[model samples]
Target chain A: MKISKEEVHYIAKLAKLHLTEEEADKMTEDFEKILSNFDAIRGVDVEGIMGETFKTTEAPHLRKDEERVFEDKKKLFQNTLDLKEGYIKVPKIIE
Target chain B: MTITIDAIKSAIEGGERLTEEIILQFYKRIEEREPEVNGFLTLCRDEALERARSIDQKRKKGEKLGRLAGVPVAIKDNISTDGMKTTCASRMLEDYIPPYDATVIKKLWDEDAIIIGKTNMDEFAMGSSNENSAFKVTSNPWDTKRVPGGSSGGSAAVVAAEMSVMSLGSDTGGSIRQPAAFCGVVGLKPTYGLVSRFGLIAFASSLDQIGPITRTVKDSAISLEVLQGHDPMDSTSYKGEASSYLESLEKGVKGLRMAVPKEFFHTKGLDPEIADSIRASIERYERLGAIVEEVSLPLMEESLAAYYLISSAEASSNLARFDGVRYGYRTKEYEKIEELMEKSRSEAFGKEVKRRIMMGTYALSSGYYDAYYNKAQKLRKIISLQYQEIFKDYDLIISPTTPILPFLKGEKTNDPLEMYLGDIYTININLAELPALSMPCGFSKEGLPIGLQLIGNHYSEATLLRAAHQLEQEIGLKSPIRKEEV
Candidate 1:
């Protein structure tokens, strides 16, 4: 269960994060300790238990799928980092 | 002594005190104690005064006032407030002013509650101790040297310090109850969907819930009345009748069936004082004619691992929205879109936030999904079924809110596993998605407050509040802030 720096780097990359060498080293140790403790779960016999995906106390009652006007459209657009012509500007994706 | 919400409401109604004067008095206390406690992240002094004056004017005109008329209430940084910053105590949302109010905030306004300020919390509600906050650490009101249990630390601290009449806090695992226990106030986490989570900043959406932190059980019950209900905005909001928590407050715990899970008493690292306090509280319930029994929830041993895996997995997916997108912080240096997102997240998120994301990513990764995520899912069912069986025969369950006393700052920051293990007592309740609360039972020899948790079945907030109110009367453990005044 000892996680390596390489694995930490791999996980960080998937999580859209980059770690310094020091942070990766510390994270590797943390993963090792936490995963070792989590080994306790390995012994539990969940033999006939069904895995739960979505947990809700009651069934979700969906609202009507109708569009409604947002009165404060201007304020909504103003919070964006960059707004150009009513579109949120971001790093260009097109080549 | 700290002024209770009941006192303020009656004073306003009886023409003895103006709401404005009461709000100003709370601000005076905040000015005195906030520097040392670090509870508030943003203050709304001018707006609070204006609202208080309007409330007074309405009373003068003989108009109907809201339940919380003129009461100044603090909100956790994660809950959105219209035109106010909801930072989640992370640098990413440091300056993010939400355009719309959260459903709970809107409900508070409708009830005539004054918005005092947004309080601090752990970054994205990640850590157990308030030290993980990117801005500053919130100290325990009882003892400034000890850490305030978090990520609802600021909400609990402000109420305990008499800075606000009540505060809203979100609990993913034990955020609300743990901090309330440490700060010696009352905290209640209602049944998962009983309260709307429309604008609560998502941590683990499935497990996350917003609850109240208050100075007394009665105050906690009243706040829940104002906060809970079905909201069209939140699809998962409970579509049932909201119970009258206040009407049942004085019903007492007589003839109630209470269960003390055997495993909780023997949890490793549990402080002896906390254990004694919880046991003593159970005895008090028995003395008041409660039929106390010992029950076994053997699956409890596996709860912490299940909680961490499931919550972290959910958090990893939910937090992916924070990638230098339409809002929040963006890195200044980035060439490509991917680089923009990666750099922005890495630069803005704190250490604990990154750690959880990594853990979650690792758990949900292709190769290890079954061993970690799926296994945790199955364990969740087994654990919840165990509680379902117990609740069928018992009216309530009791345990220590936190296994150990609040530790000093930096004590467990280096060892995240240790901090995670301390949550053993409270994490399972979230897995079951039941209502539970924490109220001060007694104080340790060092004068640190100790709390005992009372748990109830789904949507049984009225029952839980009734039992807790009775215990509050029996134990009569006043707020540590009041002790200071005495």
Candidate 2:
């Protein structure tokens, strides 16, 4: 249950979060406390129970696939933080 | 005038009051009380007034309006509304206005319901109290220093304060019920998939449900009737005929079997007064001819562990979309793309949110998925099966909604363990995907409200509402005494 500084860094990298040394040290303690709490569940026996996904009595409804026309292009860009040539701009994935 | 949904609807139809006048009243209340309560994140003054004026015109012209016509309603900040900023109480999405309205919001609009405003919540619905919100903490109308529970704190606070007639709140691990309990209002977390999740900002997709928080049980039922239904857009929505929850409100508990979990009653740290109130409620139910029995949920203790694992893992994935590149707050002065993402997320998200995301990432990592995430999923099944077995013998399970009444703000802010324990009685219901309702049953010695939770079988909201309504009538729990005049 102990989260080392290295493990905190690893988690941060995976989550795409950049933490300072002080933040990492603080998170290490928080993570340790949370993980230790979760460790309490290990003693419980849960054999032969199938994992349930979404709960519903009926099957999911499928809509007929059809081409739908877009009515509002200006509205789509109303909330965009960055836009260029009528398209949302993002950090370049490929350069 | 009564602020309940049924009363408002009756008044509007009877021509006793116009929709415009109702909206004006709500605006005045908000203007007077919001400085102290911090209930709403976005108040739709112009749009709400316009809609209300239109409804008034229709009434004057003798045209029929929709069921919820002129009924002012508040929406949780996480639900998307077209052209309005849907912050989810996070700085990362502070400027992110959704291009499309959430399915529930659209339905409310179609029903001619006036969208009064968007209420505050835990940032990304992550915390137990409203303290984690980036904007401001929502104060309980009952006591200004105490927190209205979260992440639906603002929604419940608004309903309690009479700032809005009814408000929508999304429950993931008792977000709606806990807050409603704290604020002394009625809150419902419908059976998972009973309501559509389309356009709801994803937190834990499998567990999250949008429900109603209102001043009365009947108002909660009427709001649920408008909100619940199948939507083809959301894969998890239930495909069945929708029932009128309000119509089933008067189906009194003549032969209903209620189960009180011995484990829930024996839990340590439960307030003695809260326990006494719940016991009193059980006595009332017995007087009403309902059979009450003690039941044990053997797997209940492990629910919090499983909930943390599953919810964090899903949240890490769901919140991954909030990169600086998308339609949200982005950091400046980053040299590389990696630095850009890292800096933006770390700077924008709160401490609790970051900690959870990191924990989730580790749980879902290649080396530990089986030990943490997968094991939690298997434990979830066991918990659900336990409920299924118990439901065969009883129609509903009853418990104190929360162990403690609403604590003063910052009381448990530094102690994460203490905060997580706030959800002890409620998280198990969400894990089992069962419908549940929280209603004010009694008042604490300190005058704070105590709520009794009624957990029901899947799609058994009608029975749950009926039981809660009957108990509400018998006990006559008064509304949380407001600190500030509305």
Candidate 3:
């Protein structure tokens, strides 16, 4: 419940969000209040209950394994912020 | 009087009013009122008119019309609209136009429902009020100074203001119902998996379901009929047969066993007027020969904590795809790919969204997973089972849609926990994967609308709508919001 600014920054880093010092301070306060509220779940007695996974009352329907090409490749790629040679341009990750 | 979807259909089919004329009339209203309400993020007036013209031509050619012919609908910004900007009211996707339509959008088009525009919402459906929208704050139609409970705030506001007869909104944790309650209209969060989530901008994927906001229960039923069905595109889409919601809507709630959860009434900060209104509505059900009982839901206390953890965790995962490389906004300055993603997300996402992602990241972090995320999931199962146990004996559960009436704008903006606590009555339904709806029950002393919620078992939309329809007829609090000429 008592989330420190360092912990807040670490989480933000994991989430790929950059936070300024001021924002980190504010988020730390917000998280402490919210997590303290969330801390109420810790006292819950889940002795016999299973943690929910992908279980449904009815069997989920699986679609037929078929491949169809999307017709609008031009429109699809148009949303790319930077497109060159039909590939999205990004800062080199492996260099 | 409000123009129901049925009225619109009849008038258009009977040639009393042209589809084009109906579209134009609503557009005129939108032009007059939308500036003040800020309900719409984007308006497609020309395309809507073009669609209306085509529908009219089909009618003139003696072709059979779709069920919702000539009806105009506003969509929440989160739902995909091919070629139309679907911003999610976030700076992140400010210019993003989806290349393909959402399953629900395609269904709307099939029904001949004209898509007038995209309505505003909380950025990524993260906030309880529309104030979180990056572009503008959507004002409540009843009281402009008050917040329209959100993240479907604009979807509810447009219908309440009669700018659109119906709208589609997504509910993760009462996003659709709460806003509808605040705006004095009908909002239904259909049973999860009952409606396809394909092309919905994901926010807590398991909990999120698309539903309708409308002026009448009948309209909500009809909208659900169009929106609900199996979609091969979404793997989680329900394969089970959905009931004919509109057909069974008039059957009434006679002999139906209803449960009033005692915990909902006892929640802190529940307005006395709203509680009285909910109790009065329950009495109306009893008067209609329905057996109503007060039951205990012991797990209700921890629902908020569990819901927040689960939703935020799923959101953090789902939203990870929003890096600057593909679509959406990109930061101008970033030397490394890592910096690019971090900077873009931090620059574009609103305060609440960042907080959620951070919280989720922490919960799912190495050491805390068992303590936080896993615990929340366990709590979710327990809470969900508690509802299932209650439903074994009761056909419906009734509660206040919102514990408090709509508050003034910026009143709770600084306090996230305060906003989260207001959702106590509505979040548990999402966790339980049940269908629930909010309809205007009465008005408070200040003349703001108070909402009563009716909840039903999974995929039981027909029963939920039927009971709401019956009560709508008996407790006729007609036009609780101030009706401006539109």
State candidate 1's DockQ: 0.71
Candidates 1 onward: DockQ, in order: 0.71, 0.59, 0.71
Q: What lDDT tens digits, residue by residue, belong to model 1 across residues B1-486?
A: 556778788889999989898888888888999999999999999999999999999999999889998888999999999899999999999989998999999999998999999999999998888888999999998889888899999999998888888999999999999999999999999899899999999999889999999989999999999999999988889989988889878886788999998888888888999999898888999999999999988866578998999999999999999998889999998889999999999999999999899989999999889898999999887777788899989999999999888889888988898888878888888988888999999999999999889999999898999999999999875665653321
Instruction: For each candidate in turn, give its C-alpha RMSD to the true structure in angstroms.
Output: 1.5, 1.9, 1.4
After TM-score superposition, what is the CA distance of residue A89 in candidate 1 from its true location, in Å? Answer: 1.9
Query: How much is B111 displaced in model 3, in angstroms?
Result: 1.0
The model with the greater DockQ, 1 or 2, is: 1
Q: List the residue pairs that clash in candidate 3.
A: none
iRMSD for every model: 1.7, 2.2, 1.7
User: Distance from true position, residue B353, model 1, in Å?
Assistant: 0.4
Task: Report the lDDT tens digits of candidate 2 across residue range B197-299.
Answer: 9999999988899999988888888888899988988887998789887777887899999999899878879999999999999999999999999988765
Q: What ranking of all candidate models by DockQ puts the best one first?
A: 3, 1, 2
Q: How many clashes (backbone N, Cα, C below 3 Å) per candidate?
A: 0, 0, 0
Q: What lDDT does candidate 1 reach at residue B455?
A: 92
